[model samples]
Target: MAQKLQTGTSKTTRYAIWAILILTVLSTVALYASMFLSQDNNYKEAKVQQDNYKKYQEATEEYNKKADKQAKELSAKYYNSFKEFRKTPSAFKASDVKELEKKDLKVGDGEEITDKTTEFYAYYIGWKPDGSVFDGSFNKDELKLPLAVKKNNRGWGVIDGWSEGIQGMKVGGVRELTIPADKAYGSNGSPNQQDSAKSIAPDTPLKFIIMLIPKFEEIPQPNYKDYGF
Candidate 1:
């Protein structure tokens, strides 16, 4: 009877071991399936995000093209209008302008200009080669302001054409300057003006009537070491 009981006990122990082995195998398989599903979901999400980004890039490019096109059209319209205006005899005729003449200018010939300076001045009317008024200083009465030349400012603030054109002009001298766009505002006109007035897109000509005023000296340069600045 004792031997029979021992055999039964061994059989029960073997059955329990088999059951534990089966459970472990099932758990491992379940864990593997979960991991695979998680990775697949992440891959799908990444693909979708990439597709969205591609679409966004394409849209941005299209928008820029459209904007550029519109800007060109607007510029063309303005350029044509300006041309038409020039054709009119009245447009070329201004009562304020006494005469049109050309004068050669030299460097360092004008008044000695320091870093920061101001001058009271008047001018007739200035035009680009296209006969557009680039500087309407003559249209106004008096201009009194400091001309800045430092970084982020209109340093050495002189229009290229005006500076070069009025070299030998005596103080209180008057003259008309017909400047090419290259000498005036170049491809991009002065900032803060209308787009139509810019030199870039339309690249219109420039003209000017300049009057010289008394030149003033600029403030002396500060010694950085003295202020420990």
Candidate 2:
């Protein structure tokens, strides 16, 4: 009877050890499966985000390219119409600009610039008496985008001649201005010292052909948040 009881106790001990080993193996397998699932989910999410960003970048590039092309085409259209006025005024002399003088190149039926504070956009070419172009809105033979002159409550944000000369001119009008030294840069070459390209000699007269155009609408840049950044 004593031998039988000892054998039964040994069998129970063996069964408990096997149960513990089996439970440990199952736990290890479960842990590995959970880790692999988490890693796979993270990788998929990263891939999705990368693909979205690439699509957004491509869309933004295409949008900007179209906008740029449209802008260039518009500029060229207006530029070609007024490029003929780029020639020097007939018998133009710096001495002839004793006072602010103006000659209308083309009259427009659009809204008149009745007030000095009325802001506008224009394409212009300024030249010295020698017919050398000092500054202009042209790039080689092509015209660049129109420049905006912001409104100032005080008056026009330009030379005294422009403020007075632009009066009564309508939108889409072209005007040639012969500005005297007093109404132009005066004794100073330019108000901005860093602007060496536009600088002129003291007491020098200048001429310009101004083409007023409609306001330009700007294209907005793409937002990162819109692309699920």
Candidate 3:
């Protein structure tokens, strides 16, 4: 009877091992099936995102090309009109410029700038008393697009001399402004992006040749979602 019990125990252990191995095989098969079924959806999502990004890139490129062309054409037209006044003054003294001075180069017959709150577009060249050009709206030989001067509490979002000097000036006009140090950059001076070597000095009087022009065609901002940005 003891011999028979030992044989039965061995058979039961073998059956248990077989059951574990079958369960493991089924689990592995189920895992692989699940992965296989979801692969199509994952691939579709990746393709959709890729297509949207491509569309965004194309649209942005087209928009930039058109805007650049329009700006260059506008710059070329007005640059020819204002190019003659791009000359340094013969004699200039910072101390002599105690008050804001204005010398009209070409007076315009267009709309008159009545108040400090008037918004306009302008092309300008600013220099020091020593005739060093610190900044301007020019790109080497060509003029860049006119910068939009928005209205502020002071005047056209500019310094005291510019606000006072440009008042009563009409569109399509060009004027030369000689600003005193107090009305210009004042004591702290200003930075020069064009010539990083020559920054505006403290108590430095400045001069500017300004040309006012009419507003250009507005370019709407591209939607970020449309560009996938």
Candidate 4:
């Protein structure tokens, strides 16, 4: 069994919900793996990685808590800025996911988001052509879109397809990316795949609605300066 944190209506935020969703899938494996390691008295490097993971999550929760009020405000600002571009997330007919494609619904005047850019913040909704919303950051005020791919391995800001697709988006832009499975979860679905009322199967092409947000809290990534990975 996994450990549970004390959460109440008063303390809950969208960010917290995001954390729970992430931890639910990934942390379980880490927790159980750490338990097995202790019993076996195994390799110390795994222990180090385990400790790093715990510390990273703790630091993140702290940041998310502090950024709660600010994040909502940012979401609102982005909403207003992109309201015209916003649309309900919907999917398309079966298409090859191997071919990466992108089209802009709304364009922004801000700086381009590139692999060299360190900070990334965005709001997104992901669904299939059938109109099933698999995952999204905001319940309202977002758009017709695709992935908010981050520049590099930097904590995998988005999927491989997203990484390439979201390259030139301005801070205020909205884009729709159609990703083939190869750039997404591929044949092996993600271990941390969001739990939805609808199932996301392996090898399924995905349609995503993404809005590159400015002024939201900075996404957490390891300091490359300190730890070169």
Candidate 5:
């Protein structure tokens, strides 16, 4: 009877040991599963962020390209119109010699001017050959823009006709400048001037009646004079 009781106690001890081992294995498997799931979530989030960033960069590039293209087109159109206006003869004739007479204006011949750069202040009425005024900036209250001729970098500022016609005037002089269509707006009129109906066509001839106000300061002669004999 003593031996049988001893054998039963041994069997109970072995069963308890097996239960403890199984519980430890299950706990380890659960911990590993949770860690793997967390890592996967983090990887997916990082991929999404990278994709969004790429799309934003592409959109910015496209916007800049479109803006640059529009600016180039506007500049080209403006220059082309100017070229066409230069070719018309009607742009050269004075519209009002009588008005010029009332002001006691004396226009100097193209030859008497010595300074390469001519400066003047003048009121102007610009019109198409058809007697349509497209742009006129003549007003006593308005500030006149100084125009210079033959200056190395300055001559390019004025329109082609103003540069060519203004050379004859002296300081405190006034005259009407009639620019031919080829030298004026040509087929494309002033881009800023809106028609009364808001439907003016491009490349229309431009005309102007300019008065010479004062001669611009002459460009300084280089010191090459000191080197001369």
Candidate 6:
């Protein structure tokens, strides 16, 4: 074992192997880091989309509730009279407007009305078959509405049904009148949409609660020009 130069691995070979190992480790680390970042980004995007979908569902629910409420209010017109209607009549039906039907809810002690009185100092609520109010005179002080028939053989101020229906009613008496379309605006229906979202349809039946007995007076003359009478 004299001094023999032991040359194990050369420096170049050792350096090359070390470099390859270092490069492989760096590449593996880079790949794992990139995969983690990508997964994180995907998770964040999915969460945001889910939140957006949840918000949309909530908004749609709210809108549906609001719409249901509005629809209920709109349809409430059919039964509103149950609050104070003393004698709710039977379900009304559409019939030919050739006759008038009258029923007394309460008879008064006052004298019966006369045809000489062209107008009556009374108050009334004109309700439709569905219990929706189409018109009313009770809002004003003792309303002086013209009678269906005048003193002379004059034209009817109101509908013919009302004229015939009020025949035997006395002052302070309440009467319910069922009027036909012919006695009202006729088959053409009223052009004035004065009720709740319902224009009086043609051939529609009408009901009325009329009360008599007040100071006799006259309303101001209506301008035909203004009302297109």
Alpha-carbon lDDT, every model:
0.49, 0.80, 0.81, 0.68, 0.48, 0.63
lDDT of 1 by residue, 1-229 (tens): 5654443457778899999999999999999999999999999988877776666666667766765564354334333322322322123432233333465232223454332334433324445443555434221223223232322355335656665665556544555575565665556756644655533333434555554544434334334333322
Error of 6 at 163 (Å): 0.6
lDDT of 5 by residue, 1-229 (tens): 5654443457778888888888889988888988888898899877766666666556556655664454344334333323233223243333432121122145533333334543344434556655555554322333223333334554546666666665555543444555555565456645544446322345444445554443433333324223221
In candidate 6, what residue range of length 10 has the lowest lDDT sum?
139-148
- Write the residue-wise lDDT of candidate 2 on 2-45 in tens digits: 65344345777889999999999999999999999999999999
Once fitted onto the true fold, the runs of candidate 5 whose alpha carbons sit more than 4 angstroms away are 1-105, 108-115, 139-154, 193-203, 215-229
Return the TM-score for each candidate structure: 0.34, 0.61, 0.66, 0.57, 0.36, 0.48
Best of the two (1, 5) by TM-score: 5
Q: Model 1, 26: alpha-carbon shift in Å?
A: 56
Off by over 4 Å in 1: 1-124, 128-135, 138-156, 191-202, 216-229
Clash pairs of candidate 4? 91-128, 91-129, 92-129, 97-180, 145-208, 145-209, 146-208, 146-209, 146-210
Off by over 4 Å in 4: 1-65, 83-86, 96-98, 140-157, 191-194, 215-229
- TM-score winner: 3
CA error at residue 172 for candidate 3, angstroms = 1.2
lDDT of 1 at 59: 62
Q: In terms of TM-score, which candidate is stronger, 5 or 6?
A: 6
Please count the clashing residue pairs in each candidate, in the order shown: 22, 0, 0, 9, 24, 1
User: Which residue pairs show collisions in model 6?
Assistant: 172-212
* Residue 114 lDDT (model 3): 76
**Model 3, 29-103: lDDT tens per residue?**
989988987997889878888888888777778878887787688877887887777775444777788888899
Off by over 4 Å in 3: 1-64, 89-91, 153-155, 192-194, 221-229
RMSD of 2: 8.9
Any runs in candidate 6 off by more than 4 Å, and if so which?
Answer: 1-91, 95-98, 138-153, 193-198, 216-229
TM-score between candidate 6 and the true structure: 0.48
Hey, what RMSD does candidate 3 come out at?
Answer: 5.4
TM-score of 1: 0.34
Cα misplacement distance, residue 198 of candidate 4 (Å): 6.1
